[model samples]
Target chain A: GAGVSQSPRYKVAKRGQDVALRCDPISGHVSLFWYQQALGQGPEFLTYFQNEAQLDKSGLPSDRFFAERPEGSVSTLKIQRTQQEDSAVYLCASSLVATYNEQFFGPGTRLTVL
Target chain B: AQSVTQPDIHITVSEGASLELRCNYSYGATPYLFWYVQSPGQGLQLLLKYFSGDTLVQGIKGFEAEFKRSQSSFNLRKPSVHWSDAAEYFCAVIEYGNKLVFGAGTILRVKS
Candidate 1:
């Protein structure tokens, strides 16, 4: 079976440009999550979705970061006006249950703001 | 705030040597603990998890972790490591919002 997948494995953008990252979760996965991993650091939670509902977005850094999982199978993370600080790898994960389940992660999209 | 800690930033061991990576969490009760491995330019791979019962849990790739409630620790151990095991290891815990809080990670360097 296929695991979680993300698009645009690498992205390069100029400062102030907008960027969007896509994630395709595993089939029938009810829970999805997004994380950001900075260079030489552990990944930090960004947001979570259960089905089509955006249950938690507390980890989103600022108003510029927005995520949507309209149909519950695919999710997107968008950033308005990219900055150098936003240069990092964005990771997506999915699980069979809502919580306490093993999260299968995608390869992630590395965004580089030049 | 809840957090996970990996005391060692890096560890270098010869092939076939025993290995242990420490992990500690700050939480009121026992939370779901997990160990994950990530190779360069790859996503995290679940090694094992400890939910309940059985303090010692075996994971894939010949890895095991022991959870100690009294110590608030879940340390990963391997009897003999292989050269291919060189990668980054992370300790994570499911916090209040069902999101994982990860530690700074430990880089394992296996010398053959």
Candidate 2:
């Protein structure tokens, strides 16, 4: 079986540019999550989705951040007007249930804003 | 605010030696605890989880974790570590909203 997969394994964006990171969750995974990891630090929760519903976005840092899982199988995290502080590895994870299950992860997308 | 703490930032042990990584968490209720491993440039891999009904839960790759409700801890341990086991380990607790709050991670360095 395939695991979660993310696109643009590495992305470099100029300051004030916009960037979008994509995540393809495992088949039938009802719960999806996004996290951000700064250098030398642990990952921090960003947002969560249950199927097509964006249930939790509290961890989103600011108004520039947005996420969507329109079809429940795939999700995207978009950062508008990216800043240098937004530079980090964007990680995506999925689980069989909506929550409290073993999460399967994807190879993250490393975003660098210069 | 809920938080998890991995006391050891790094640990070095000889191959085949037993290992323990301490983790403490702060939450309001019975929390869902988890341990995950991540290799360099890779995403997190679930090692094990403690949902209920068993203080000691076994996980993949010869890893296990013991959850102590009184101590507010879920420490991960492996009896005999292999060189390949060297990686970053994280302890996390599930928040009420179903999102995970991770610890500062412990880096394991195995010396053969």
Candidate 3:
């Protein structure tokens, strides 16, 4: 079975540029999540989606960070007007259900804002 | 707010030696705990999880963790660690519905 996968394993963008990171969760996964991991730090929650609905975006650091998961499978994390502080690895995870289930993670997209 | 704490920044142990990594979490309710391992250029892998059981949970690749409610700790242990076991370990707690709160992580250095 294919695990969660993210596209553009690496990305380089200039400050103020817009970037979109894509994630394809396992088939039939009902829950999807996005996290940001800074250098030498643990992953921090960014957003979450249950099926096609956006459930939580509280962890998003700023308004520039946006996410969408329409049709309940592929999710995208878009950062508008990228900043140097946005340079980090963006991780995506998916689970069979919304509670108590182990989340399968993707290799993550490393975004370096120069 | 809920939080997790990994007290050790890094630990170096010889191969075949016993290893223990401490993790403590702060949450009001009964919590769901998880241990994840991340290698360089790799995604996080689930090591194990504790969700109301016998307190001792066994996981993949010769790993186990004991959850102590009284002490608010879930410490991971391995009797003998291999060189391949060297990686960053994160302790996380599921809170506010389904989001995970992760610790700072502890890096393990295995010396052969």
- What is the alpha-carbon lDDT of model 3 when measured against the actual structure? 0.96
What lDDT does each candidate get?
A: 0.96, 0.93, 0.96
Best by DockQ: 3
**Could you report the DockQ of all the candidates, in the order they appear?**
0.83, 0.78, 0.84
Candidate 3 residue pairs in backbone clash: none
TM-score to true structure, per model: 0.99, 0.97, 0.99
What is candidate 3's lDDT per residue for B2-61, written digit by digit as tens?
Answer: 899999999999999999999999988889999999999999999999888689999999
Q: Per-candidate RMSD vs. true structure?
A: 0.7, 1.0, 0.6
Which stretch of 10 consecutive residues in model 1 chain B shows the poorest summed lDDT? B92-101
Misplaced by over 4 Å in model 3 are none
Off by over 4 Å in 2: none
Q: What is the DockQ of candidate 1?
A: 0.83
